[model samples]
Each structure stands twice: as structure tokens, then as C-alpha cells.
Target chain A: MEIFIALLKGLLPVAYLICLWFYGQLFFSADETKQSRWAKLSVAIAVCMHTALLFSLAAQYHRCPLWTQGEALLFLAWMLAIVHLLSEWSADTRRLGFFTLGPAAFCATVALSFLGKELMLDAQYRSSWFIFHIVASLAAYAAFSLAAVLAALYLTLHRKLKLKTFDLTFRKLPPLDKLDKLSAMWSFLGTLLMLASTVIGVWWVRRDGLHGMSPREIGIFVVLAIFLFTAAARRTLGWRGRRHAIWILAGFAALVLANLAGLHGFHF
Target chain B: MILNAPSQPQVFVLGANHLTASVSLRDRLLLDEKSIQEFAETLLKDGVVKELSILSTCNRSEIYGMAEDPKAARTHIENAWAARRNVSEDEIRTHGYFLSETEAIRHLFRVMGSLDSMVLGEMQILGQVKDSYQLASQNGWTDFYLNHIFQSGFHTGKRIHSETTIHEGAVSISYAAVELARKVLGDLRGRVVGVVGAGEMGELAAQHLHKAGARSFLFFNRSMGPAERMAAAFGGESRLLSELQEHMGQCDIVISATGAPDIVITREHVQGALRHRHGRPLFLVDIAAPRDIDPLVGEIENTFLFTIDDLKNAVSGNLELRRQEAHKAEAIVEEEAARIESWSRALGVVPVLRTLREKYQAITDREIEKWAAGQPPELRTHLESLGRGLLNKFLHAPTTRLKQLGEQGDGSRASYYADLLFALAREEKQHGD
Candidate 1:
């Protein structure tokens, strides 16, 4: 059972790499009419494999896959893949897949390496509320990560346009305005999820009479505040383009740092 | 350079194009769709050409045909074209060029692939070719030879279109604006495009943007009459020059092509529009000769500005890239033309092989009848089937070798050798004839 689980976990990144390669071909190649079907199929295959791996891991451990840091990393990667697929379908922007899948593959690889060393299951593994909180937080992180990726793409394209390069990368990227809008959209969703996760965490803390805030909680609060400010500024002050994209990237960086510190046993 | 023998049907093409004739002469020699159909039918019905298709575009007029007597067919086409257009035969002879056999095959491929077009790598020639071929096919004027050439031509065109960057970028000034807008703004649906000056360039730019999926347009001119006229033409609203800044905020793309001696759109105008735009970028194109928009407006945040020189530079670059890609496309045409020629050559031996097979079957049938004379009815039928099967098996090896020789362009000599070896009697008439 352990061998099978490890094998499935190891295969996760390979699936994502294949999916990425197909999307890369679809974007870089001039003929998209034929490569699109294979790209979509590859995404479906990767998503299905990741879903099966998560469920099998959950069954093997006889608990939700949100308890340990490694398992949570795996879940986060799965959520990112799900979010990418959903966005690709809803947005009609398949070219963004090449950008998003790279990180998903990298995260899965990291989780595989970490799992090989040890599975650091937390003490609050049995708490259902804690599981929900972790799930929401990771989901928010996934959304923020996607938003940052989009922002980076927007900046790259914007610079290329201003400079008038008109190179292959310039041709392959979605329009600057579309990228900006999609980045804002993902940031808005991430902020809402982060708020929900923060609220759940506070409620659980109060009910259980836990101690003061952890560093991870404070970091989430800061990231949440940045996104909220971004959403507010765009609405009230008309903040856009480079400033908006930079704000999203900074917020994502903060979120990543906070998660890393929290995983290292940093407390309030 | 003919791939087939002297006795085989030869492919021929005769035409005059932009390089060979002036616009006046080309226009005078023009054949419309109805006339092209009539012309093809007349030639096919009169036995002047075995198979025929005619392509008549504004830039060129050409006839592609297969005939046993290519010189006669060429002469007939020349006289007929001159008579129809009321032009002298001397005029036709002065402007026209004729190609036969392999030269004709290569010319057709190059035309379909757009390598021979006035604008290298233009895409309309392929569609024109397909239309011509379809007309011929519908009227039963074309057969296996013409069909093979057209199908191969289309394949080559498709390969060049997709595998190379020949048609990747805009080559004209007006279209460059639309291409730039698409790159900056992505899909232009639901986007408002503003046109200024009501000049020809502005109208052309607006037309391109409309085709690129922009629905709403606002035209601003110095006079209200031309603005309204342009607005009515594009289903857009007309605004005065005074309201340019007021309505500029609502526009995602603005094309300025006025004949004003000084800059009509200042930096302050763009700044005012940007304040009301709420973060959405603006694309501004200045196609005026004395430049209507301020060059400094390009420095403003969230505003992309292009002048006539910039558009020209983009177009020239794109054209250069297409020229490079044309070389690659020419290579593809050469390869595909050779392939079709080989396939056509292989068809020459098919008749000889069929006749040989028939002779063998006749001898086998005679022997089977004598052997089964005393057998039962069921047994006789089985014996006849078995003898025919053996005959086919015996001929299969030689048939494969003969096709190989034909495809290698030695078909006529191979057919003669097969006839001598088989001692088969020649038929008085070919199957289709």
C-alpha cells in the first residue's frame, strides 16, 4: 500500500509536465487548430490523475489529505490544477496554461521530495474545523498564485508592447488588458477565500480557547489586506496596469513566505 | 522536362499578370465568372482541351488545361480570348506567356501557394484557384489529371500557410493598426473605437477595426457633414472635433488621420481622457502626414500611441519576414509539384498492365473450359475461379514492377517492353475514349 501511494505521488509531477508540454506546443506552434484538442486532453488527464492520487492517499492514511504539510502541499498542487482547468474553460484562455502548470509541477515535485524524507503530520489533524480552515487557506493560496502568474504575464506583455518588440512571446501572450482583468479577478477570489479562512480560524480559536495569533495567521492577514486594498483602489481610485500587477505579485510573495514560516513551526 | 511521353496528354497554362501587362490591358482582357465558365465549357466541348479550369482575378487571368495537342489548344485559347474581349490577336501575343508540361505544373503550384502573386504570400490566390477548380468540376469539364494537379496544389498551399510564417503578420499600413490593437487589447469585441478627421486613412483603419470585432465606433471630423457621412457608413455615431476629448475617454482605440497642419490631439487631451478612463489603456494611431497627435502623448501611462512612420515600419518588417518565408514556400511548391508529376507518370503504365492481365485471363479461361468439359456444373465453376485466381497471382509481381518503373519516369519504355513480353494485341480504342 505504501509503495503504491508513493508511486502515484511520484507520477504526479510527470503528468503535469506532460500537460505543460502539450500547452507549450499549443501556444508556441502557429497551428492551434490541431494542438488544442491534445492540450485539453492532457489537462484532463493530469487533473484526473492528481485527483485519484489525493483520494488514494486520503484512504491510505485513513484521514483527510489536509493534515500533514506534505499532504497539504500535494492538495495545494491539486487545487491549483483544478483552478487552472476551471479558468481555462470559463475564460477561453488556454495559453495561460503554460504559465500556471509550471508552478503546479514544481510544487508537486517539492511535495514528493518532502514526502520522501518524512510526513510531518500536525497535532490538530483530528479537528474537522482545522481541516476546513487549512483547505480554505490553501485554496486561497492557489488562487493568489494564479493571480501572480497572470500579473507577471501582464507585465511582460505590457513591456513588450511599449517597446514594440513583437516577438514570439509577445505573439503568444493574451492581450495586456485581458491579462490585467483576469489578474484582478483571480486576486479578488483569493482575497475572498483568504477572508473566509481567516474567519474560520478565528472562530475555531475562540471556541477552543487557543492562545495568541501565529506568524502564519498574521502573514495571511497582511496578504489579505493587500488584496483587499487592491480591489478597493481599483474600484475607488482607478489603480491599474503596472501598479496593480506589482501589488498582486507582492501579496503572493508574502503568502508564500508566511506559509513557509508556518511550516517551519513558527508560532504567534 | 515533360514527365510523360510525347503521345501522353500534356498539361499547359497560358496567362498574363501584373508583371506582363499594364492595368489597362489586364482590365481589357478580364474574364468574369460567367465568362470563365463559358470559356472552359467551349474549349472542353470543342475538343480543343481534354480538361480545363480558368482562374480570372483582378490582377491576373489564366487557363490551366490538359490536351493532346497543346500548341493547338494554346492557339485556340489565344484567338478565343482575343475575340471575346474584342482585343487584337497581336495584343494578346504581346502580353501573354505560355507554359507547358513541367513548367505548367510548377506555375500552378506556385500560384496556388501564393509565391507567384503580386504580393508574395497573399492568401486569396488559393481560394481563387479552388473556385476555378470547383466550377470546372461542377460542369464536368475536369478529369483525373486536372483534379490531381489542383488537389496537390491545395495541399501545398495548406502546408505553406501553416508550417511557415508567410501569412503571420500584417503587410499594410491600415491593417497594422488593427494588428497592433489586437496585440495590446486582445479580443476587440465590445470595445469602442474612435476615428478622427473622417479622412481616407481613418476610414480604412476604422473598416479594419470593425472587421476585427469592434462594434461601437465614434467618428470626429472638423466638419459635421463628413463625420456624419462616415458614421452612417459604419453604423456609428458622428461627433464634432469639439467633442473629441469628451468622447475620447470612452474609446479603447482612437485613429487620428486628419489633414491638419498642426497636432490636433495634445498631451493634455490624452491626460484628460486618461483621468476618466479608470485604468483601461488607450491605443492611439496618428496616420496624418503632418501628424495630428502629439508625439509626447505616447509617454502617458496606459496610453499607446503610434504614428504613420511607426505603422510603415511595422508593415515593412512584416513584408520582409513574408519574403523570407516565401523562399520556404517555394521549396514546398517544388516538392509537391514533383510528387504530382511522379504520380501522373505512374498512371501511364496502368493500361498496358490491364491489357496484359486480360490476355492472361483469356488463355486461362480457354484451358479451364477444355479441362472442365466433362466435370459437373459446380466443379466447372470452381475450376474457372481457381484458374482466374492463379492468373492474377501470376501477374501481380510484374504489375508491381511496372508501376515502380512508371513512377520512376521510365513508364513509356516499360509499357513497350511489357507489350513485347506479353505479345498482347492492342485495342482499337482506349477505355474512356
Candidate 2:
């Protein structure tokens, strides 16, 4: 059973990588809209395959699982992609699939690399509050991922239009104003979700009698504060266009740095 | 079918115009409602012509008809015009020009296209030609051939206008004068206009000015009655020729259309008017052939004088520009004409080919029926089917080859194949009989 679960987990990253390749081709195609739709379908299939692998691992372990670093990474990546897909579906921002799916494949591959060894599971993680906190935090991160991609495309297209070197691809992207609106809306939702996740983490830590500030917890708070502050600055100054795009990139970069440092140091 | 060749090519065009004839002749030949109805009845009763139409306009009178013979049709038309005018046939025929079929067809095309108008490219002639044809159709004088020819001519005229820039600008002195006035003045709405003569040229210019939105029209002529008539037609007031200088001072634009052998509006007359009026721009159109307005009068401040030569020069210049654009349009017309001609020729060949095929099939059926009568009853059905199949198989290749040839350029070769096929079908029929 362990062997079968490991093999399935190994196949999940390859399936995600295939999806990433299809999406990359789709982005470069002349008929990008048509290719994007095809990419969405491929990603949906990849998500389903990854979910099945997660289920197989859980079933094989015969516990609530979440032991190996590989399993933890795989679960986090899967949750993030699933949350992004749901958000995109609700928001109708299918163009973000091209950018978001690449990172998703990268996370899946990294998770697969850490797939073999068992890790010590935190006792507090079994609590329902812990589950809600982790789920909300990952979901918030997924929305931020989509917001970053939109901001990048918006800035690139805006620059091209300003230079009067507008090509077919730039024309296919949503107008700059629409991109800004989407970015702001997604970040706002992500900040709210992160706040909810933070509150839930505080409740879980208290119930489990954990001591002050783990590196991962501190990283989460710092990243949450960046998003919250950026959102506030955007509202007050009416920050938009290039300025807004730069701040969004900076905020996403801070979150990535915090995640990498915390997750790698904690081996999570 | 009895093939009796046509007796003679009978073609006649009776028309009156400003050129080669005058208004007297045109008015004389103009058919009133009763006369037109009577003329149609008489022509049909006498068998004088098989097809006919009377095209009447303000400037010209024309009778187009096909008769048993050209001379007879010509004589009938001449007598009709003479009878209508109560004049001798000799008097009218001497001035009338008779054209043959080709000349008549080209003339019809040109007339419908407005190339034959007193003012070339005048749009009035197209509507006039259509109305004339409608009248003939109403009188039951238009036949299949005349209907086809006239309709095609009308279409050709439309094609010429749409495809070429030939009619792009005003072609007459009167219209060019109005066009220049409008161009200089922007809009003529509610502007006062003064006319100095009641000659045909001046009357035309005044009429165009009034149509362009002149609110008050004041006419002055040597004869007051004609001036009164002209003013009333345009809803304007008639002033005495003595009051012309006073009216000219008050008017925004002045048009001189007189047959004066000398300059009618001298430099002194215009300079006096310019003093009475606060320095306002005055547009002067002199449409007389012999120059009615003095050329020196243009030296007066705020006065713009346009002579007949100047207007004609503008007309000719615009006509040249239009001619260039018209060349481009002509290319389009030629392409479309060729396309339509090809389609028409292909359509004409289709019925002949169908008949030829039917004739061959009938003969083959007859021959097989004769051969089947000598066979046993059971074998007859089988033999009939076999013969029909064999005959179709034999025809398949040739029929396809003929259709392929028909699809190519100069499909007249298909008609020759049709004739050969018909001959073969006849010979087979004779053998079977």
C-alpha cells in the first residue's frame, strides 16, 4: 500500500508538469482564448489526479496522515491550486490559469521531491481549528497568487500600449483598468481570508498550549501584514497603474520569501 | 417551326432638343395624355410598327419604334410628328436626324447616361428617361425587345454613373455658378438673390439659386412679363429693370443671364452698388454666352465676378478631374459588363443543350422499343434495361466533355456541339422510323 501511494504521489507532479507545458503553449498561441480554455481543462484533470493521489496516500497511511514533508507539501500545493481554480471559476479570470498553473506545478514537483520520509506531525494539527486555519491560509495565498499574475500582465500590457508597440497578445489581455480592479478585489479577499486563518491559528495555539511565536507563525503574520497594509495604502492614495503593480509584486515577493524561509527551516 | 425572316430592320428615333432644334419643335411634338393614347391605338391598328415608345422631354421630342421596314417606320414617325404640330412632313424631316439600330442603341445609352444633355452629366435626364419608359409601358406600346433594350440601357447608364467620376461635378455654366456661390457663401439659406435677365441661361441659374435656399428672389428683365413669370415660379418678386441697381445693392448675390451682345453690368453700375451697401461680399454670376457682366467690374472691392468663360473653365477643369475618376469607374463597368455577358451567354446555351440531350434520349428509346418487339416477352424487359444502360454509358463521356467545354471561355463551341448532337439524334430517329 505504501509503495502504491508513493507511486501515485510521484505521478501527480508529472501530471501537473504536463499541464504546465500545455498552458505555456496555450499562452504563446495566436488564438490565446481558445488555448486558454484548453489549458483550463488540462489543469482540471491534473487537479483531479493530484487529489486522487492525496486520497490514496491518506488511505494507505490508515491515519489522518500529514506525516511526511512530501505529503505536507503536496497537500499544501493541491489546496492552493484547488482554491485558485474555485476562485477563478467564480471570478471568471481564466487568463490567470496560464501564470498560476506554472507555480502550482513547481510546488507539486518540490513536494514530490520530499515524498519519501515521514516527518513529526504537530499534535495541534489534529484539531478542527488547525484544519480551518491551514485551509484558509492556503486559500488566501492562492488568491494572492492569481492577483500577482494579473498585476504582472496588466503592467506589461500597459507599458506596451504606452510605447505604442501594441501587438495581438497585448490586445487579448484585459484592459489595464480591469486588471487593476481584479487585482485589488482578489487581494482584498485574500487579506480577509488570511485574517480569518490567523484568528483560527491563535485559537488553535491557545487550545494546544503552544508557546510564543514559531518561525512559521511569525512569517504568516508578517506576510499577512504586508497584504493588509498594501490594501490600505491602495484604498487611501487611490494607488493604481504602475505604482499599484509594483506594490503588488513587492507584497507577493515578501509572502514568497516568508514562506520559503519558514517552510524550509521548519522542514515543512 | 416556320422560320420567316424579318422583312426589314425598322428603327426610328424621333426627338427634339435644344441642339439642332428649338422649344417650338419640342412643344409641338410633346404628346398630351389624349394624343398619346390615340397614337398608341393607331400604331397598333395600322401595323405601322410592332414595338414603339415615345420619349418626350422639355428640350426634345423622340419617337422610337420598330416597323415592317425602316422607311415605313421613319415615314410613320415623321407623319405623326407633323400631324401633331400641324406642320408639313417636309418641314420636320429636314431637321430630324435618322439613326440606324447600332446608332440608336448607343444614343439611347448616352441619353440615359446624361451624356446627351444640354448640360452634360445632368441627373434630370435619368429620371426623365425612366418616366418616358414608364409612360410607354402604361400605354402598352413597349414590347419584349424594346423592354429588354431600354431596361439594359437604363442599367448601363446607372453602371456608368456609379463606376465613373464622369458626373462627379456640375457640368453646366449655370450649375457651376451656383456651386461656386455655395462654396464661397457656405450656405445660401435665407440669402437675397437678384437676377438681371430673363434669358434661358439666367433663368436656369436663378432656378438653381432658388433651389439652394435663396429666401427672397428679385428678378429684373427688359421685359417685365417674363420676369414676373420667372419670379412667380420661384416664389420671388419681379422688379423693373430700372430698379435693378437698387435691388443689386440690397441683394447678397447677383446672376446675369441675358442675351446682351454687350456687357450689361458695367464697372460703374457695380461700383455705385458697392458704395450703397456696407462692404458685404457680393457673388456675381454672368452666364451669357457673349459676356453680359463687364470683366473690369471684378476690380470693385468685396465684389467677385464670374464670367461665362470663367464658369466654363471651372466646369471643364472639374470635368477633367471627373474624367480621371470616370476612367477608374469605367474599368469597373467593363469588368461587370463582361461578367454579365458571360453569364447571359451561358444561360442562353443551357436550353439548347437540354433540348439536344432530350432529342438523343427520345431517339434511343424509340430504337430500343423497335428492337424489343422482335424479342420474347421475358427477354424484352431485360433487353430494354440493358439497351438503356448501354446508351447512357455511351453518352456519359460526351455529355461531361460538353459541360466541361461549356464552363470555359467562349462557350459558343457548346452550341456547335449541340447542333452536331441534334443532327445525330435526327439520323438515329430516321433509321428507327
Candidate 3:
């Protein structure tokens, strides 16, 4: 099991390294559509490889890898890569591969580096309900990461545009309003999914009397609250541009901290 | 001595442009397409220039051709311009820039590549050159040399176009408007562009918008006839100017260039359109001097408004950017010109090289028959091989060196080598005959 985990972890960075090269070409190369299309193709291949690795680990453990530390990290990176692919397709921005894949590579490297340290998970995690809830929560975090990357891009392009220095820089990005709309849409979907997952996990914890609600659970709820507030304010108070972008960032930041600290109480 | 040697019938070009001649002179020299063809026929008939092509745009008029008596051709062109424009021949000569041989070739190359155009890296000149070449070809004026020159010029232009970013950005006001639309709307495919007014600026804006991939175009003008005509040109429909309110909601963009003294589209009309659009972004471009759209309409959310001044600023910025690219394109033009000049110089010696090889083969065949007379079949084959191989090896060095000198564009040295080779061939012919 350790050998399998180690091999998969090793393969993850190799895929990421190839993806990084393609991302550089996509961002720094000419404005030809073919180059970006190939870059997106490489990213898709990497995601597929990561997915195959996750399935192998799942087959080895005889359950979903969600309960373990290294496997959970790997799953988060996998989800992030998929979300990034979604963004690349939806936004049609050739310059985004570097920003999107740079973060995914970091997540994957950290995930792969920390592999084989997963303590054998309990049979309780074998339940499909608990698996679905955790998967939902991780996917939410993935969507949030995609949203945060787009928000940062929006802010950067907005600054460049305001300065009237928009020659070749940020030329491939979607328009400001288009970026904002996408960010908001992703944030809404992420937040809604996170809330649904949180409710499911909380109900499971209570019904099974597994344990008390951890601070990680409360932290996720807080992130969800921020996302909901931002959505409501954008409609009601016309909160837009930097304010909404910042709100999404803060929520994603909270999720990151909670994930890295392993404060969701499944840690060994 | 100069009269004893024949002069080659070489291509020469003489021209005046906005740079050298005033607008009035250029206007008088303007030969439209059909007239330019007729002028070419006249030049051919007059026997001043053997082959002729006329390129006359609004800003420049250049007559390029192969001339048997180039001095007479220059005098004829000057006298013709003087007589036609009622100006002195000396005055016409002073205004024109005359070029022959290498300089003429380079100038035509640069013209085709648009390095010599008023707008740097402009694409219109390529088409114009192609048209000129086509006219000359159809009229049986162009020979192999002129055809080769034009085809090479076109290929060079195409290479420079793809290799440089010369044509990447928008440099004119109409194109700048399209750039702004693309910047704001990502891709304008499937979007509707509403053009209000039948003015030239409005028509140009609509045309640019159509080129930028706006699927549907709505033309609203007080003058119905021109509006429908513009709509027909764009493959779109036209409506009355008063119906802008109804059409505004469907349009992703609005370009207004009406000649009204007062504001035509007020804030109220835009607000109503905004309510119906469901908060999709709408780009409004007002190009009229007296301001067709109200300034207050710009304050509405999801409505981005720009004026004629804004477009001018964009045009200046984009033009400056293309100017930088033009510098890079100039380097490409210089390199291509040098390369073409080398090939042009080499073209003179092709017939001489062919005659030299034929002469060598004749001598070798005669020697082989004499040396292998009454020998066995194997000995005869050996003699033939020995003679042919020696002849090829003996000829190789001189052949390579002369080709090198030919491509170096030393016309006198290449001509001297050709004369020397022909003399040797004539000496060998005496022995064979």
C-alpha cells in the first residue's frame, strides 16, 4: 500500500511539471488559439492521470480515500484541477492556465509529498453518506479556489485598465464585468454545495453520535456565511468589484487554513 | 566604347506621392483601375517602356516598367505629366523620384510590403500590386522577369505579415471602435450592433462592428434610403430613427453619429432599454460632434459609453503601437530586398552556364569516340566514363565560383565571366564543327 501510494505521488509531480511547461507556453506565447488549446489539453491529461491515481488508492484502501490525510489532499488537488478546467472552458481565456495551474501544482506537490503518512481509516468512513458529504465539501473548496483565482485576475486587470496601461498585459482575460459575473457564479455554487455538505456531515455526526462538532465545522459554516452575505449584498447593496472579490478571497482563505491545519477532526 | 556595348532592357520606376507632391498634383495623377490599364496600353503602344504597370492610389502614383531606352522613357514620362497637368517638364521632374535597377527593385518590394505606404504595414498596397500585376499579365505586357519579381514580392509581403505583428492592432478610428467592442464584449459573435443615423461615421462604425463578428446589425437613420442601403451592404435590416427605443433593447451595442444639434437619445431611453436587457452590458459609442447621446445616459449601470474623442485617443495609441512593429517590418523588408537582389543578379548567367555545359559535353563525346575507336565494349564504356567524369570535375570550380559572384550582385564581374565562358564555348565549337 505504501509503495502504491509513493508511486502515484511520484507520478503526480511529473504530470504537474509537464503541465507547468504547457502553462508557460499558453501564457507567454502568441495570441494564437491553437497554443492555448494544446495547453488545456495537457492540463486535462494531468487531471485524468490524477483521477486514475485516486481510483487506485481507493481500490487499495477498499473505500474512498476521503478519510485519510494524504489521500484527502490528493483528492482536493484533483478537484481543483477539474475546476480549473471548467474555468478555462467557460471563460475561454488562454492566459489563465499559468495562474490556475500554478496553484493546482502547489496543492498537488504538497499532497504528493505528504503521501503514505495516512493512518488506516476506520470502517465508519465506509458509509456512503459520510463519503458523499466529504466529497461535496472538497468539491466546494475546489470551486472556491477557481473563483478566487478569477477574482484576483479581475482585480489585476481592473488596476491595469484604470491606469490606462493595458497594452499587451491582460489582453487575453475576459472583460471586467464578465469576470465578475463568473466569479460570483462560482462562489454561489461553491457556497451552496459547501452548505449542503456541512448540513449532511453535521446530521451524520449527530445521528451516529460520532463526536462533538469541531471548530473546523464551525469555520466552514463561517465561510459559507461570508459567501452568502456577499451574494446578498451584491444584489441588495450593489456590492461589486473589489468588495465582492475580497469577500470571496476571505472565505477561500478560511477554507485553506482549515484544510491545511487538518482541523476538520479526521486527523490522526 | 559605351555605344559599342548594348544596354540591358532593365526595369525602372518613377513616382510622386503625398511626401514629394502636393495633394493637387497627386489628385491630377490619380488613375483609377480602368484608366491605369489604358495608360499601360498607351505606354506599350508608345514603345517607351516595353512592359508597363500603373499603380495610382489617392496618395501616390508610380509608373513601373521594363524600358529599352530608359532615358527616353524618363523624358517621355516627364513630358507627358507636364503636358497633361499644364506644368513644366522640369517641375514634374523635380517632384518625381526616379529609380532604376537595384533601387527600383527594392522600392517596389517595399511598396508591396507597405513599408513605403502613408500608413505603415497597410494591406491595401499588396492587393493594389496584385491588381497591377494581373492587369499587366492579362494585357501580355509582363514577361518571366516581371512575373517572378511580383510573385516574390507578394511572397515576401506575406512572410513579413505573418512573421511580424505589423497588422495585429487597430490603427484607424473605425477599427479602434471595433477593438473597444472586442475588449468589452470578449467576442462579439451572436451580438447585435445598433447603428443610429445615416452619417458616414455611423455607417463606418456599423461596418466595423459587422467585421468584428456582430451577427445582427440594426440601422436606424432619419434618411431611410441610405439606411436601407447601408443595411443591405451589411446584410441587415433598417428601421426609422424614432424606433431606436424599441431596437435598443435587442442591441448589445449602440453607435450614434446623428447630426442633431441637441441630444438625440436621452437618459430616459437608455434606462428603459436597460430594464429590458436584464443587466447585460451595453456599449454605447457616440461619434457625433454635437453629441447625439446624452451625457447623463453614461451613468446607468452596465452601460459603458464612449465618444469620438475616446476613439481618437485609441487610434493614436494603436497607431503608435503599429509604428513600433513597422520598424521590425522594415528590417524584414531590407533583408528580403538584399536576398531578391542577389537572385536578380544571378539571373543573368543562367543561359551562359547552360551553353558552357553543352560545349563541354560535345568535346568529351568527340574525345571518347576517338580514344575508344575499335576497342572492346568494356574499354569503350571505360573511355566514355573517364572523359565525362574529367570534364565535369574540370568545370565544377569555375561553375561554383561564377555562381557565387553572380549572387554577390557584381554585374560587371558576372558579365565578364559570361563573356569569357561564351568565348571558350565558341573555341570548343570550332573543333566540334
Q: Ranking by lDDT, best first?
A: 1, 3, 2
Over the stretch B1-433, how does candidate 3's per-residue lDDT look in tens digits? 0001235578788888878898887887777777776666666787778877778888788888888787789888777666655567765687878998778888888888788888876888899888878887888988876777778789878866765556666778887778777766667888989998888988888777777788698999887898899889898889998899987998888999988888989999998887767556688899998999998776676666778887787777767767877777777778877877788777655655666777778779988889888889999988888987898898898777767777886645665656664575455456568
Q: Clashing residue pairs, candidate 1?
A: none
As a TM-score, model 3 comes out at 0.70
Mind giving the per-residue lDDT tens digits that candidate 3 earns over A1-268? 6676567678778888888887776666543455566686788788877988888877886767777676677888888888887777777654677877777788788877667675766765567788879789888988888889889987776665444444665455667777888899999989888988988987876766677556776777778888999889878776776678888899889877766555456522
Of the candidates shown, which would achieve the greatest DockQ relative to the real structure? 1
The reply for model 3, stretches above 4 Å from the true place, is: A1-92, A95-101, A104-148, A154-166, A170-258, B1-11, B22-24, B32-53, B66-92, B137-140, B172-175, B187-251, B254-273, B286-300, B348-405, B408-433
lDDT of 1 by residue, B153-190 (tens): 89999988886778878889999999899878888989
Q: Which prediction has more favorable lDDT, 1 or 3? A: 1
TM-score: the better of candidates 1 and 3: 1
lDDT of 2 by residue, B1-433 (tens): 2111234334556655677676676677677666876776776677878777777777666777766576777787678667766666875676666775656665667677766777656668888888878888887888765786688777877776754446655677788777667644546888889988887777788778878888799999888999999988988999888788776888878998777788878888888887666444577877777887888877654566777776777777777765555445445445544544444334434544565566667777788788888788878788778877976887777666555565554445665655675574355455568
Better of 2 and 3 by TM-score: 3
Q: Each model's DockQ? A: 0.51, 0.01, 0.19
Pairs of residues at least 3 apart in sequence or in different chains that clash in candidate 2: B14-B62, B14-B63, B15-B61, B15-B62, B16-B60, B16-B61, B163-B329, B165-B326
Query: Cα lDDT for residue B118, model 2?
Result: 76
Tell me the spans in candidate 1 whose CA falls farther than 4 Å from its real position: A1-15, A41-45, A64-66, A204-212, A264-268, B1-6, B88-90, B213-215, B356-401, B410-433
lDDT tens readout by residue for model 1, A81-109: 88898789888788778988777887887
The whole-model C-alpha lDDT of candidate 2 against the native structure comes to 0.70
